[model samples]
Target chain A: DAGITQSPRHKVTETGTPVTLRCHQTENHRYMYWYRQDPGHGLRLIHYSYGVKDTDKGEVSDGYSVSRSKTEDFLLTLESATSSQTSVYFCAISSGVWQAKPNTFGSGTRLTVV
Target chain B: EDQVTQSPEALRLQEGESSSLNCSYTVSGLRGLFWYRQDPGKGPEFLFTLYSAGEEKEKERLKATITKKESFLHITAPKPEDSATYLCAVLASGSRLTFGEGTQLTVNP
Candidate 1:
């Protein structure tokens, strides 16, 4: 266990509503990432945080935003949820070193935008 | 651009049978290739990492082998419990991981 936890194992929100998903890690790793898994697209990166305040956009990060105010928590928010934003979100943590190690993931959050 | 492609979007095998899954990647400055297993409603679990070509890793009945352009995950006498989606990812000169559409393996008992 990498000591990672994701909130709201399942959620249903109306389109145009705002939704925020939380990813908490017990391990003091320096790297945290958020990804969405869809049936035909596989796993696509949304955003990632390297430190408390260091974040970078991913390929599919146009409609999503992320914040990491502290070391153990990373929050992903969709300002206005859309049906296309519905996906299974996953949280991952990794020990940032020269050569990156494999990341450990949390139980995913399945969000449905209805 | 880093690209990863996995073949046979889905595979069905009888229990105790052995098979292989393929992952081909195109990237510059290849840093690492990773393998993961994911259940129906769960997140991906890390299985192995191959940094260099010719590097191989084994755990239980799964063996992952890597080369310059591709990687292969070989299963030896797989059981029903091993049925799950297998994902392949590669990290190129950056911190991002480019993933291939996973292979859903169904091992029937």
Candidate 2:
């Protein structure tokens, strides 16, 4: 029940096409993250932003990129969509680093690349 | 790498049945352990946060306890609505949360 929302709740795009997912938070949290959820992989972080204009790659950052223009918005972009990139994407926000406080997750965005 | 493993990939309990789920983890310095409930198609809902070994926290029918290397989620008199995937994650020294695969529970009526 956090004040987090993901845009384009659902999207479908062709392979090799560009795709971007948006995460917006009204809480002004300092940390924002993008993760993809797969059946056996659970949730794997693709990218994270600690502050505006600051970003870092996660375990599965390959082919994925993120940008934070402001504290309230985090964007995840897939250079070129691939069938393997199809999964439920979740955006999480935390007031403090995950080590200090638990993060709040958005409902999620389901993306399918055919 | 810091890792978390949850057991009983899937569980089924009849109404009123009691059970427990396990979350085993390996971390350099465990700052905190958290439990979350995620219904299918919905983001996880935070349940409890345990700060240290021998610590325990409870809400309604769910209770969470932590030890040096693992954590336990015990369900009491579970109801049909108590069905969902229970996820466990650890907050390590640097504030990164490494999550477990989760245990999917189904409480039949």
What lDDT tens digits, residue by residue, belong to model 1 across residues B2-79? 899998899999999999999999999998999999998888999999999999999999999999999999999999
lDDT of each: 0.91, 0.90
True contacts kept of 1: 0.62
Best candidate per DockQ, number?
2
True contacts recovered per prediction: 0.62, 0.62
List pairs with backbone clashes in candidate 1.
none
TM-score of each: 0.95, 0.95
Error of 2 at B103 (Å): 0.5
The superposed Cα distance between candidate 2 and the true structure at residue B93, in angstroms, equals: 2.6
True contacts kept of 2: 0.62
- Colliding pairs, model 2: A99-B95
Scored on chain A only, each candidate's TM-score is 0.94, 0.94
